[model samples]
Target: MTTANFVDRPATAPIGEDLRGRVAFVTGGTRGIGAAISRSLAWQGATVAAGYGSHTAHAEQFRADLAGELQGHAECSVHQGNVGLPDDCRRTINEVIEQHGRLDILINNAGINIDKIVLKMSDDDWMKVLAVNLSGAFFLTQAALKHMVERGSGRIVYVSSLAGEIGNIGQANYASSKSGLFGLTKTVAREAAFQLERAGKLTDTGLGITVNTVTPGYVATEMLASVPEKVIDKVKSSIPLRRLGRPDEIARVVHFLASDASSYITGQVWGVNGGIDM
Candidate 1:
């Protein structure tokens, strides 16, 4: 609430190098928006653990390319896990900590969508979406929280969707899962603050454990590869920006939220949707 509270806070590094000496874990980090997020964080000097589900080849390629591009400036390792499984989520977090020694950032970006109207949507479709998108984020965050709280510093960012804010016609399952992230964000933010304070980690300068969400509009990713061109055109026209969002654009917002610059921010849903109305 006041500048005095923020003075003298320790940072991982200077603003530009804020992520130096930090480690981040990104779910679904091998492709699409998730890949962009992993790259952005690593570029800022964070060692990243990128999680993938079934795409072994794609994940390996991403790791190789990112490593080559960074050229030892940063480190990225790929981990395989089904985020929807609670045990897998916990194991992934433990593995990252075991490898990197610490995890300072968590990006819950793994998600899947099965488009179907409510009436036509089967229970499997709805449950699958929620399992991967909503439940997975929760379990991953839960596993990461203890470590982050013990260290007295961390960042958690949920990558949501614009459809969560403004419902889509045939994506009831996907929209529900995405919207669920909003409640999860707010609740976790409060709990993290409370736990930090209880552990004597909270101070006038802030402990820096923060939880937030980033909702992106239609991004030009493989996710849209199957959509008809005409439908894509119509969707773009509906957006005020007259184009689908880019992965990097979403990543930029995520980059900020995961940095020390966002220490004072939490429990908020940031829209990076090219001016699309909520």
Candidate 2:
């Protein structure tokens, strides 16, 4: 009996350089977990488009670091956009496609949180969080999906939060937005499969579209700077690992999902939390 082409790879084969020729677009790619993700993917060989919001100086620095100090096997470019706006999402997607000619991976890691209890949350706070975290992901995915569907190959990964799975205090809007990603991931995975099948690209060894979500627990980043030290200590004690997660830790999982090695996995939520959900 002969094995299928896609199944013929050696079990012990190294998959580290699998993304050598791929192109990735990472929103919020200038800082925090997103920056780490950009670095991780680029290190593995993917040319990256690092999307940032209104941080020109920071974005420039990030681009410089990628192009100079952190230079590796990949080329990295930075793009600016307010993900909360649909126009910005579409525009940035176009820019990446034009710059790279093709986009093989889409990392919807751009998100914002407006921390306010249900009663204390104002209309702007709710809408702003939803627009950036949930709506931005949808718009960006919508744009990228069209291109991916036409090419019949793509990987989409949404970075969510543990707060989405288990409610967080003073973060009703933020939690809701992240939770929405679960439904989006599953639906996009199913729809991409169906579309590829219809296009005759869903062959036994060819089709490669996949969509998944990565939910990280509290990580050490600038986002945590505003939290009181006492609260930080308490958060650390509550985690099973008794410490905050590192950005690279989450980025590694994301790098896997963005690689061909993860072709068989999709529509799943990977929790990179320190056993927080468990």
Candidate 3:
């Protein structure tokens, strides 16, 4: 190709794609990895609806941060709802569509970890983890699928964990929920592809709406604060990189999946575990 034909673009182009007018919904978007994902999407020009369950103060602070950091490059609004509840999921999805006029991306990042040995775990603990981590993703995706299928394009990225891939001690409930998301991601990818084909919207590569998962290893977040420092040190030692993955590192992968660069990619799990899974 001629030099003139090869247009050199800056490495930082907002969102790596021209998502100037898209709409995205991120669950648990007020903190940690979800916050990074929300900011990344917003920076790329998508109007973001950040969903949070509790943590009103944290959520409000996140909104303020976005307002200051984004500087009107994009819009981000906070919505309160528990993804575990079907009613809340439905209502939240409806609210996003009503406000933004469309929904293009759905990030199932809301999750809770209740670490307890299987023998000692309570029914409430197991159920709560699964409901929030696994079922919530399904409920939200189901609610958003209608709009995506009608529009014939969408992106769904589930936030899984390395614990799900390689089971962690005293995290049976959390592991199961994260593993369940793998199945959910693949199934949804196939179904959405079928729908797009039926609608005569499939690309030449037979691709349409994409569904994927991102598995992150240890990260320095409030969630990790619950872990004993000694345990974290042990984890760091185990990792080949001898470090924890950053939320933004995981968000970068999510951004790629959310962008047009990953148009032909679906039903995949991108791990950001700093060689821990190797």
Candidate lDDT values, in order: 0.88, 0.88, 0.86
Q: Show model 3 residue runs off by greater than 4 Å.
A: 1-17, 205-207, 226-228
TM-score of every candidate relative to the true structure: 0.92, 0.92, 0.92
Write the number of the candidate with greater TM-score, choosing between 1 and 3: 1
Please give, for residues 1-278, the per-residue lDDT of candidate 1 as tens digits: 12121121112222246689999999999888888888888888899999999969988998999898777888999999998899999999999999999999999999988888899999999999999999999999999999999999999999999889998999999999999999999999999999999999999897469999999987877666777888888887888888777677788799999998899999999999889874
Candidate 2: which stretches are off by over 4 Å?
1-16, 70-72
Give me the displacement of residue 150 in model 3, in angstroms: 0.2
Q: How far is 235's C-alpha from truth in model 1 (Å)?
A: 1.4
Report lDDT (Cα) of residue 85, candidate 1. Answer: 93
Q: What RMSD does each model have against the real structure?
A: 8.0, 8.5, 7.3
Candidate 2, residue 156: the lDDT equals 98
Candidate 2's C-alpha lDDT? Answer: 0.88
